[model samples]
Target: MPLHLPHLRSVINSDGAAIFDAEQGTLTTLNATGAMLWRGIEQGHSKEQLLQSLADATQLPEEQLRLDIEEFLEQLTAQHLITSE
Candidate 1:
């Protein structure tokens, strides 16, 4: 499934990112790492690609990153920040 951001507005900076969901009238903040991952997802990167890139960038184990990414995606979904299509 591909992910889509609906009615989204955002600002990404060196420190972090702030995303506003116009549809939900809510704001969410992300750390630098989360901002990077979110950018990759917005650019249409696949889940596997995101895992590899994060693993390479952080030099962390893919297994742990996988769990973290799963959790993050779930949060995004629960917040309606992203949708699968």
Candidate 2:
């Protein structure tokens, strides 16, 4: 099955970011770049979608964002903020 990200609830702050799972009582932190990508996700963005969006928003190339994008997705997925579907 494909991973999905629609079940998450997120909030942004000056210091960092938070993705919360109400059922689990868990909260995750996002670094500067991770915060950017997490905030960019809306209705439809895959891991690649986040990478491209981050590149465009930061004026960086997709290749430059690739590794970080993959890492971010990993963290999100590990925490159930996103799915692997």
Candidate 3:
């Protein structure tokens, strides 16, 4: 699946990222890890590429990272912050 963000504005920093949904008038803050994932999504990375890249960067197991990514995706979907294609 591919992910898409609609009407969102974001600012990323060394510490984290802050995303604003202009349509919903809501703000979301993400930690460093989340920010990395968000950036990957913005770059149009596939789920597998994201998992592998994050695993290499963090030296974490791919299985755990996959679960984490899935959970994060679910949260974004639930919040209507992203749509999948």
For 7-85, candidate 1 gives per-residue lDDT tens digits of 8988898798999988789999999999988888888888898899899999998999999998988888998888777
Candidate 3: where are CA atoms >4 Å away? Answer: none
Tell me the whole-model lDDT of each prediction, alpha carbons only.
0.87, 0.69, 0.86
- Supply candidate 1's per-residue lDDT for 63: 96
RMSD, every candidate, angstroms: 1.1, 2.9, 1.0
Residues 7-80 of candidate 3: C-alpha lDDT, one tens digit per residue = 98889887889989998899999999888888888888998988988898899888899999999989988877
Per-residue accuracy of model 2 over 1-85 as CA lDDT, tens digit each? 2243545678887666888777677878877777777666544566667767777778876776888777767766777776654
Which run of 10 residues does model 2 get worst, by summed lDDT? Answer: 1-10
| Residue 37 displacement (Å), model 3 | 0.3
Off by over 4 Å in 1: none
Winning candidate number (lDDT): 1
Q: What ranges in model 2 sit over 4 Å off?
A: 1-7, 13-15
Candidate 3 lDDT at 38 equals 84
TM-score of 3: 0.93
**C-alpha TM-scores of all predictions:** 0.93, 0.69, 0.93
